[model samples]
Structure formats: C-alpha cells, structure tokens
Target chain A: MNVFADAIAWIFSPDRASGALPLSEAIWTHLAFTVVSVAVAALIAIPAGWLIGHTGRGRELAVALSGAARAVPSFGLVLLLVLVLGVTHKVGASTTAFVLLAIPPILAGAYSGVEAVDRRVIDGARGVGMTEAQILRTVEAPLGLPLLIGGLRSATLQVVATVTLAGYVGNWGLGFYIVQGIQIRDFSQILGAALLIVVLALVLDALFALLQRVALPRGVSAGRAPENEPVRRRRRGPTAPAPS
Target chain B: MTWVTSNLDLIGRLSVEHLRQSALPIVLGLLVAVPTGWLAFRFRPTRGLVLGAVGLLYTIPSLALFALLPPLLGISFLSEANLIIALTIYAVAIMTRFVSDALASVEPSVRQAAVAVGYGPWRRFWQVDLPLAGPVVLAGLRVTAVSTISLATVGILIGIDNLGYLFTNGYQRQIVAEILAGVVAVVVIALVVDGLLVLLGRLLMPWTRGRRAA
Candidate 1:
C-alpha cells in the first residue's frame, strides 16, 4: 500500500522533471516517435492498400506479408536494426522498426475498408460515369471511413505500445523509467512509469473508439447500409471478402 | 553464424523456456476466456461491461504490464510466474473477445434446432455450439498463440530468462548473429505453433474441412 502511494507520488513529484530527459519531455518524445512512425506507415501503406483494394490485386501478398511481419518480435527487430545500422543510428533503426510494426493494421484497415464497399455501388457509380478516382474519393472513402479509422486506431495503439520499447535502443521515452528502474530495483519508479503508459494508451484507445463511432457512416450505424455490410474488424483469418 | 554455432546449447535452452513460458499463457488464457466468453455471449446485460473491461486490459502495453504485475501479484519482480501471469492476462483479453465473437458466429437457428431436439443447454453447448464456434475460436487462438510467443520474449527485460536475452546480450556485445538467432527462433516458434493450431483446428472440426473444400 505504501509502495502504491509512493508510485502515485512518483508520477507527480517535482523531482521527476529533473531527470536527464524530463518526464514531460520523455512523454513528448514517446508521442513523437509514435506519431511519426504511424504517419510514415500510413503514407506508404494506405495508398498501397487503396491501390490493391481498388484494382482488387495483390491482396494475398498483403495478407501474407502482414502475417509474416506480425511474427517478427519488435524487440529483436529493434536490437538487430540498431546493431546492423550501427548504434549511432539508433533513431533510424528504432523508427524503422516502429513503422514496420504500424503498417500491417493500417494496411489491413485501408484495403479491407475499401473492399467492404458493395460492388454494385461501385458499378452504380461507374454507370453514372463517375471516374475511378472520383468514386474512390467520394463514394468508397466515405463508406470506408469507419474502417479506415479502425485500422488507424489499431495502428496507433500498436505504435504507442511499441514506443515504450524505444528506451531499449538508448532513445529516451516514458519506458526509460521502467527500464532503468528495473536495473536499480526501484519498484515505485517502474510502477509509476507503467501507470503513465497504461493511462496514455487507454485514453488514446478511447479517443479512437469514439472516432470510429463518429466516423461510422450514418447509414451503416443505423443498420440500413447493405452496401457497407460486414464492416466489422476482419477476423484473424478473414478471407478477403470475395470480390463479387 | 559462428555465434549461433557456438551457442547452440544456450539457444536450445532458451527456446525450450520460451516455448514453455508462451504455451502456458495460451492454455491458461483459453481456460479463463471460454467461460467468460460464453457468459458474455449468452447474457445480454453483461456483454458490454465484460467486453469493455477486457478491452482495457488489452490496451496496456506488454512492457508496462510486465512491470506492473509484480507488486500487484505479491510476487518477485523477476519471477517467471510474473511473465506467465502477465501474458495470460493479455491472452485472456485478446481471446475473450474472439471467443465471444466466435460463439456469436454460430447461427441462432442451429442453436435453436439443438434446443428443439431436446438437447439440454450443457449438451447443446458441448456438442453443437462449441463445434460450430471452433473455426473462429481457432482463428483467434492462432493469433493469441503467435502473439504470446512473440511477447514472451519481452520477459527478458524483467530478468526472466528467454530468447529475448539474446537481444539485450547481443546489443551489448554487438553480436548481430546472436540477435538474428533470437529473431529467427522466435519467428520459427510462431510459425510452428501456428501450423499446429491449423492442424488442430482441422482435427477438431472435421466438418470445417469439407466446408472449406467445397
């Protein structure tokens, strides 16, 4: 009980800010790693996913790649990259690992969201002479918004969780306290840092869940949207909704 | 290459520990999740509350969870049990959702038919509902298995011995082969476990094989 109280106090103590990387700075650095990695991943994966979903090609490749990627432990990957790239380049190495980790969920979400839109609707849009790009922009994007956000939600959560690993490579983050505390056997510090990470992750998760709700197409939410049926997160072994 | 060749004994021991540590969580997770999932799936009122609570558990980062569990459980920070317990919590968090979803995947009419044919709830759940939920649950189990195997590597950070020791040790020693060995071993374990899961799913749910083939 006293340890718990001290952990709580540790989180709020002014002395915390006196660390090599101040507590606030550590948090921002963590957020920065998360945001930049996820953003870079989105840039590469979303467009590639859109292309795959639009053309209805390369999906098996996507699935297989993501499956293989998921099996690579992020910790080992980080250590390997840092070693391979040279420890002096730890930032690049860690960022690469983070981006790779973030890509799969976002890619899955992007492609699956677009694929979930009914084929007849795309046909209807085409029949009315909407160009490919326009249909993707106006029709598919709106209908797929909920799922795209879902993918982003998962990606963001994954990256946030993984960023806690940054300290292992000598980059500072909220994980520093936990990592360093473990070495020195400081239970209060470890618990406090863990508490911070849990709180931050949950808050972000909640925000994404809300975003998923708000971004859900009105028709889909109302249960009247046949065109967007089966918008739920793809089950682990989900076959790509068969292209009609 | 030289490092791996010379360190075969160490690698073998670490692999065995990794397998043991990861496998326990998957089994324990399934034991807890099935009933919790059945309850959440069957009871309308408890659905959101149960799901929301577990969903929150899933959000706690693995490293943080590993750090946080020691004091809470009144265990040593370096106990192998701490890693197992934390991974089990994660497996439950992940598998409970999948188990419920898997149960929900069974058609209502199928369940109704069992009830109509004088099958008691227990018999029906065991014979009909459970078999029907097998594929989806199996899918979820595969995910839980792979992830647990991978996440178990992080146990090294807390000083529990596992393949992840390679990562920390390799980094300090600048031995890339040692790190590569760790990554390969983890991936191989994941792939082997995943393959076993698929085979087990086929064995348990023979009906699914015909359906997929058709």
Candidate 2:
C-alpha cells in the first residue's frame, strides 16, 4: 500500500537525516536505554537470583516478589518518578523505571535456570570431594547457562518494549515518532517508527535464540539429536517427574 | 494525604474504569483462546504455526499496537473499543500459549485411562483433560489478569479514561501526590486481582488440595 511505501521512504528521506528526530539517533537512543537498563537489572537480579537458586532457599518469596514487581505498570512508574524526582533528571527517572521493568524476568530466569539443574549432578560433584563453590561453578553453572541466557532474552525483550515509554516524558526514542505522529495525525510517521521497532525486536529475538542454542552444553545438545533417543530420555529424566 | 482523601471519589471511579477495561479483554481472551488452543493441541501440523503467530503478537510494543489499531480497524482514534480490542488481542495471544501448555501437561496415562473407560473424545476432553489442566490454566489466567491490569494503564497515553488519567492529570498539574496515589491504586488493584484468581483456582481445583494433603 501507499502508506507502507511512504513510511519506508520517510525513514530514508534526506530531510530526516538533518532534523532533530533523525532515524539513526532514535535507534541508538532506544538501544542505549535498553542496554543500560538491562545491564543494571542483570547486575541486581542475576546475583540475587543466583544466590537464591544456589541456596535453594526463599524461592517462593523470590517468585512472589518478582510477580508483584512485574505487575507494577511501567507507565505509572515512569510518571511517578518524574513527578517525585522532578523532570530535571528525566533520563535517570526513565532508566530507573526501565530497570525495574527488566528485573523480574531476568531474576526468574536465573533462579529457575539454576534450579532446573539436576540435583544428582550436584550430589555427584559433592561425592567427588568438590566444595560447594566448586560444585556450583563446575556443575550447576554450565548446565544452567541456557536458562540464564533465556532470562536475559526475556529481560531484553521487556526492556526494549518498555524503553519506548521514555518518549512520553520527552523526546526519547522511537516512541517519540509514534507519540508525535499521533499528535500531528501523521500515519506514515507512526507506521515507520513501529516498523523499525518490530524489526529491531525480531533481530534481538533471533540473536538470543542463536545464543541459547550455542550456550547449550555439548553433550546436552548432542543428546537432543533424534538418533540419540535413549540419551535424550535420560537427559530429560531429572526434570521430568518420576514415573508413578 | 489530604489530596488523596479529597479526590477519593474520583480515584474510585478511575479504579472502576480500570477494572472494566481489564475484565472485558480477559473474558474475551478466554473465549477465543480455549478453542484456538484446543485446535493447536489436537492438530500436530498447525501447532507450530499457531504458537509462532501468537508469540509474534506478544512482541509488538503496547503503544505501537495501540496506535496501529485505529487505522487497521477503521475505528475512531479515541474510541474505548480500540483499547478493549487491542488488550483482547494481547490477552488471547498470551492465553493461547498457556492453554495449550496446560492441556499438554495433562498426563498421557490419565488421558489413556479415560479413553479406555469408554469415554468418547469429547467426554474425555471435558471430564478428564480439562479438569486436569485447570490449575495451570488458572495460573496463566492470574498472570494474564495482572499484566492486563498494568497494561490498561498505558491507555492513559492516548487520553483514554482509566487510572492512567491520574498520571497524566498529575503530570500536567505538577501534583506528585496524585501521581503516587495512582501508582498505589494500580498496584493494589493488580494485587487484589492476582489474589482473587489464586483463591478461585484453589476452590475450583479441590483435587489439587487433596493431592497436596496426601
């Protein structure tokens, strides 16, 4: 349709390059918000989750806390922070909101990932005279890599989606285009911005999927091959409930 | 404190609107997801396609989706229907996956036992599979409900009436207390809904309680 064509053209238009709302600038800003927020969230959540998963204590509390946190609306949070902190620190307020949004999934992922490791493996390591730290590092960490990465992927998606809200406070990211477009009744601009967001999200998703595959332990990955049905079944045994 | 007390009636009305906006999508989502999920589960070939489509829907940014709907649906820009429909799409997208997974979690032996006992496919699904899947499905419902409640707040951006209205109003008037009030109300609503769903799930799945007791 003409609308699609116009949006595509608008994105590459020379006039846009020199303007205040450059396409490249918006993309970079969005990415920065996502990366910074996810990094901070990972720093806070991954450690807590790792400790909780490693100790196998306070799991219910962790899950409940994360669930409640996830339910806090990012939009309200952003506005509340802006109001309380004053718009003087717009970027800081937005980053705080993004970090809050990013934490729950990453925490859950890291916790669940470590928890998903077989206790028997941990026991085996312990029997071999390995210390708790050694067992965790040598056994649990490697096996849990896939899930840790999975949590990162979930966190990334959430941050990416949420960072767009930063535009509400001011001229932030791709959301600026959508918000401004709506205000000015410019459909093409809105569509163009949305198209860019979709493409970015899809790219990130594919990259994480590849990372998940590559992060799998070699034996576990090999066990997934169709010809290795017996091995596959055995590998799954620890996770699956025991036969009644 | 005085600000909240003075605006209690307005806050109550906004909370009601928020509930209304959230509840409709969940109901609609359940109605659509059940059949679609069953179809995906029952048919091997369509499973990947169905889930892939739904997962893709989940990735769309809420604001983009909200903006995209008016043009796509030919509705007025400000229609409350836009919010409901957009939220419903998200609910169905998420719920479908949960429904299929819940149904998939029903033990094969239990299903086989139902079949062996001379139950037809419909009878087996209704009497055995569905009840078995109840807990997981209810868990999904709780998640969906909470997320929807939060997402409904985004409706404020487009000038739709809800708790988000307070966020915008407070921002415009520079009233931090009012904005904080909105935050508290939204969080409370989400928690209440989540708790109610948990209680509802427990009541409906008495077998789960019995199993836990043993």
Candidate 3:
C-alpha cells in the first residue's frame, strides 16, 4: 500500500545512493563481513572437522565445542569482545564474533560428512592398497563434498544475518540503515534496508543451493531417486546413498 | 562481582522478561508449525514450496525482521508484541522444516503396519507416526529454544527490555563486569533450558530408555 510505495520511493531516491551512508557502501560492507567471516571459519573448522572424521579421535571434543559455541549468544559475544578489545578495534571484534558464529555448522558438516561414509567403502580403499592420504583425498573428499558445501551454505546464511550487528559497534553495513531509521523514526528507510537484506540473503541461498546440486556426485544423485518411487520396493539397505 | 551483586534485582527482572519473550514464541511456534508441517507432509507437491518459503523466512536477519514487523503489523515501534511476533516467525520458520522432516523419517513399513491394523490416518498419526517422530521433534525443539533465547537479546538494540539490556547499558557505561555478567546469565539460561528439554524428552519417551536398556 502506501508504505510499500514509500519504501520503493526511498530505495529509488538519488540521495540514498549518493550520501555518506550510501546503500551500495552498506551492501559492500555486509558482503565483506560475510566473506571474511565465512572464509576464516572454514579455514579453522573444515580441517579440524576433517581430522576428527578421518582419525575418529576428538569426536567428543568437537561435539562439546559445538554445543558450547551454540549456547553463547551472538549479541552478547560481540559486545563483550568490543568491550575487552576496546571499541577502537570494532571491526576486529565484530569479525571475530562473526567467525565464532560461523564455525560450528561448517565443522559439523565436514566431520559428519566423512563419518557418514560406509565403513565397507573405506575398507575397500584400504584393500586396494591406497595410502591414508590418498584414501582421504580420493575416497572421502568427493563423497563428503555435498555436505561440506551444505556446511558452507549454513555458515554463509548465519554470517549474513549476524553481520548486521556490526552496525551496533559503529561498523558499517545494511544494519546501519535499520538502526539509523529507528533512531530517526523513518519507516520508509527501515523497510527499504530490510528489503535489501532479505534479497541479499535469498540470492546467496539460491546460489549455494545451485552449488550443492552441481557438487553432488552422480552416483549419490542416482541413489536419491529410489526413495521417491511409488511402489514401496524393498527398503534399500544401508548401502544406499549416504544422507547429506 | 560488585557490579553483579548490586544489580541482582535488575538481572532477575530482565531474566524473567527474557524468558517470557522467548518461551512464549516457542509454544506458539509448535502450535502453528505442527499443522503447517502436517500440510507440507500430507501433500507431496506442496512440500518443496512450503519448505522453501519457510527457509527464505529464516534467512531474513533478526534486526530487519524486527524493523519490518512494526510497520507490517501496525504495532508501536517499541511494542513487546513486535518482539514476540518476530520471534514467533523465526520459531515457526525453524520448526516447520523440522516437523516435516521428522514425520518423513517415520518408516514406511511401520506406517503400512499401522494401516493394516485398521488405523485411520488421524489415529495413525497421533499414535504411530507421532510417537516415532517424538525424539526428532524434541531435538528440534531444543535447538529452537536455545536459538530463540539468544535471539531475544537482539531486542535490546531497539530499546526492548531483556538480558541484552545489560549489554547495552554496560557498554554505554564502559563496565566490563556487567557485560560479562549478561554473557554468563544468557549462557546459563540456554544450558538449563536445554537440559530441561532433554529430561522431558527422556520422561516422555520411556521406550527409548527401554530399548537402550535391552
């Protein structure tokens, strides 16, 4: 209605794009926060997850760590870090908090992906005289690719949503608009900024969904079809494609 | 320590407010999600569309959603209703997918056996399907509860009262102890809620315990 019209007008206004707090600048800042957070999280989490899955050691530690990480409220963490590190390092503090938010899912994905692979498959690889490193690279990595991508998808979504908090610490992002709009009581700008965030998140989700489909191995994709068949054939044994 | 001791009454009041804001949404979410999830599961064609919509809802940032709701619902900008409704949307978004998946996980053979036993669809869902799906649904509830509790703190940014009020107040005053206390209190609430849910699940699904024992 009128509100929607106002939101559209706000978005299209030349001042919105040209000012000190330009929408494009906010968008870029949001993207930078997401990219850096996700990349650093992957660097830390994926290797640890892989090692746990590969060696079957530290499974308990990973589980406990993920639980503890999940319990820590993201807003409080950001505030605490900002306080501890001093607000002068706002970007560093916020980035650290975002990285903490991003890690658990990626770690879970990598470890569970490898662990879900059939023991018989690993035995076969060993029977064929593959080295440990070769077995991981050739046998485990491809099969776990879908889940690894899934982990990245979850991490990206979380970071995108969370990086908005950066604005609270005086860092720049789309959240700045929402925060500022609230302060000034500008409904149109608030709605406009929110729309941009929703669009950005949906676009990223779709791109990741495409990546998941493309990355899935052909053999695994074939295995997914039988579950949908109408005739309740004999339930496939555990040998069916591993769940992503 | 001195800061926390002096502010004990403030902490208690905010904790209660936080609990009210968070817990109510979860209860409301379960009520809405069960039916919506049933619809998604009952109709095969709608499953993808329904789940996709919920997934998209979840990707909307909490802050944006909070701002969007006051205008959309015609509520006051600082209304507690806005916080509750916003959190409810998130809870529904998360729980619907979990409910649908949990139902889907019910074994075909088990469902067929219930059919052969002359159970109608409604009775079968209530008895066979729901019981089997209980553990998964409970696990999802635990996750939803913890996340909702964490998210309720975001309201402090917009001047709603919750444990996060401590963070904002502490930051403005440059009192590190107050911020740390907020962090500790929120984490403790999350852990206690999670533990209670686990205990409740065990009590309700005694068969799981029996199976493990056997």
Candidate 4:
C-alpha cells in the first residue's frame, strides 16, 4: 500500500526528475532505440522476405533460422555483443543485437504474409497480364498488409521490452532507472520505473492494435475469424494432422 | 573455453536451478490456463474479455513484470518465488489463448457425436475434446517452455541466482568465454527439454504418428 503510494509519488517528484537521467529523457531514449533498431531491421528484412515469398524460395531456411534465433536469450545476446565489440562500442553492439533479434519476426511476417494469400488469386492476377512487379505491388502487398503490420507490431514490442536492458550496457534509457533502483535496493524506484515501461508497452500495443484493425481489408475482415486466430494457426505448421 | 572447463561445477548447478525455475511455471501455467481457457471456450460472452486480457498480459515486458511482482504480490524482492510467480504469469498468459484455440479447433461433429453417445460434459472433455486438443496444446507448451526458459535468465538482473548469473558475472569481468558458456548452457537446456516434449507427445499420442512430419 505504502509502496504503491511512494512509487506514484516518486514518479511525480521533481527530485527524481532533476536527477542525471530524468524519466522523460529515459522514455525518449528508449523509444529511440526501439525505433532505430526496428527501422533498420525492416529495411533489411522486408525486401529479402518479399523476394523469398514472391519467388517461393528459401522459406524453410528462413523458418529454421528464426526458430533458432528465438532460443537465444536476449540478455546473453546483449552482454555477448558488448563484450565482443568492446564496451566503448556498446551502443553499436547493443543496436546490432536488437536488430538481429528484430529481423527474424519481421522477415517471417513478410514472407508468410505473402505466402498466405491464396494461390488461385495470384494465378488469377497472372492471367490478367499483370507483370510480376504489378502482381507483387497490387496483389500481394495489400492483402498481406495486415500480417506485415503484425510482424512490425511484435518486433516493435520486442524492441521496446529489450531497450530496457540497454541501460545495462551504459546506454541511457528507461531501463536505467530500474538498473539503478536494483543497485540501490529501492523498491519504490524499481516499481516506478517498471510502471513507466508497462504504460509505454501498453500504449504501443494499443496503437499497433488500432493499426492492425485499420489495415484489415474490408472484404477479408468480414469473413475472418478473430484477429489472432490466423496468426496462431499459421505457426502450427503443416504437420498438425486433422483428427481422423 | 578454459573458463567453461574450469567452471563446469558452477555451470551444472546453475543449469539445474534454471531448469527447476522454468519447469514449475510451465506445469503450473498449463494447470491454471486449462480451466480458464475451457471457460473462455465454453462461454461465449467472456471470450473477448478473457482472450483480450491475456493478450495484453503477453505484451508486458518480462523485466517489467518481474520488477512489478514484488510490490504487487507483497513478496520480498529476493524471493525465488518472485521469479517462479512472474514466469507462471507469463506461461498462463501465453498458454490460455492456445488452450482456447485448441479446444475450439476440436471438430464440432466429433464433439456432437461424443455427446450423442451418452458422454457427459466432463467425460466428453476428458475422452474426446482433450485428446483432440492435446497436440495443439502441446505445441503451445513447447513455445512457452522455450520462451520461459529464455526469460528466466532476466531474473539475474533482479539478483536471483541461475544460469543468467554467468551473463552478469562475465560482463562485469569482461570474460567473453564465460558469457558464451551461459548462452550455450541456456540454449542446450531449451533444446533438450524441447526434444523431450516432442518425445512425450509421440509416446502419449501414438495415433498422431505417421500422420505428419512433426
């Protein structure tokens, strides 16, 4: 009870604000890390993913790579990068690690989004004399837009959560406060910093959810099962045999 | 490499602790999520609310969740319970949606046939729905296990002892080998456990064999 009160009070206090790393600054820094990393990742991954999906090649390799990547612990990745690259280049190393982490989901989403579009539809587009470029731009990109956004959404969320750890490597971000709080054993400070992160994450999630909804094509939205159902089912792979 | 060879005992101890920390949450999460997911599946009105809430829960950052748990649960910051409880919360949040989906994926006709053949709701779930839902739930469990095992490493930030300790210790010491040891150890545990789950699925669901390439 008192802890909650103190946390709220701590968040609002000018004392905490006037310190070396202010809460507002932390928020911006955290967002910057997330934005920069995800942007770089999207630039690198989306094209490769589209090529793979459009040509229908290299999907097995991509899926296996992403699955393996998912198993690497984020904390270890951060530290390993910082160590390998040297602490002086910690910022670059951390960003590289974040980019590596973000790439898999975005790439998967890109290729799978295109792959999910009905084969008949693509064939129909081809019969109408649409160039491959026209087919990719008009037929595949728009229909696959929702899932591309989903991949972006998850990648953003992942980067946001991970940007908190940026402070561990001496980068200034919202995680700085949590790291500082832990070192000092200040429960209020830890809770307060965590609250800031939670709010940021939820706000971003809501924004992305709205984006996903808005991006949904009206025709598809009309017949689609719930928003998450398709995403879940896609990952179950082809081997999920129907009950005989 | 020498760091790893010299620290084998420490690494083994931490691996045991990591496995223990991760296992409880996976098991407890399935136990809790099953009923809740069944409720969401059985009841129409609560479906949106239940699924939406858990979806939001999944978005909460793992570190933030760990930090929030101590104050919210009135547990000491250093308690191992904090790590387990936070991990369990994640597992439940991740698994509930899968459970609901797994149940929903059960064939409607199969369910109807079970009901028509004199099975009560409880018996039908046990005999027909659950077995049918098993593969999907197991799939979700594998994902949850890998993620939970990976996420457990974050507890080192809050002072909990586990394989994650190697990360912080190595970072502070600038020992790249030590850090690599931690990463390899965690990944191996995840892979081995994931393999075990696949085997368990095969043994328990023999009918699923030769049907698909799992």
Superior candidate under lDDT, 2 versus 4: 4
Minimal lDDT window, size 10, model 4 chain B: B205-214
Candidate 2 chain A: minimum summed lDDT over ten consecutive residues — where?
A235-244
Candidate 1 wrongly placed segments (more than 4 Å): A222-244
Q: Score the docking of each candidate (DockQ).
A: 0.53, 0.37, 0.49, 0.52
lDDT by residue (A1-244, candidate 3, tens digit) is 7887898799889997776588788899999999999999999999898888899999988777776676677878888898899989889988998898888888877887777677789999999999998988888877777777777888888788777766777738888888788788898988888888888888998998899889878766411333223212312211101000
What is the descending DockQ order? 1, 4, 3, 2
The TM-score of candidate 1 is 0.94
- What's candidate 2's DockQ score? 0.37
Best by lDDT: 4
TM-score of chain A of 2: 0.89
Which tens-of-lDDT digit does each residue in A1-244 have in candidate 1? 7878989999999997786768998888888998899999999988988888788899999989777776788888888988999988888988998888888888888887788787888999999999999999888877777777777878887788777876777738888888888888888999999899989898888898888788877656321233211223322322211000
lDDT per residue (tens digit) for residues B87-174 in model 4: 8988888788778878887877788999999999999998999898888788878878888898899889878899999999999999
In order of appearance, the predictions have TM-scores of 0.94, 0.92, 0.92, 0.95
User: Which pairs in model 2 have colliding backbones?
Assistant: none
- lDDT of all predictions: 0.82, 0.78, 0.80, 0.82
Which residue window of length 10 is worst by lDDT in model 3 chain B? Answer: B205-214
TM-score of chain A of each: 0.89, 0.89, 0.89, 0.90
Interface RMSD of each: 6.4, 7.9, 5.6, 6.6
Q: Using TM-score as the measure, which candidate wins?
A: 4
Q: Flag the better candidate by TM-score, 1 or 4.
A: 4
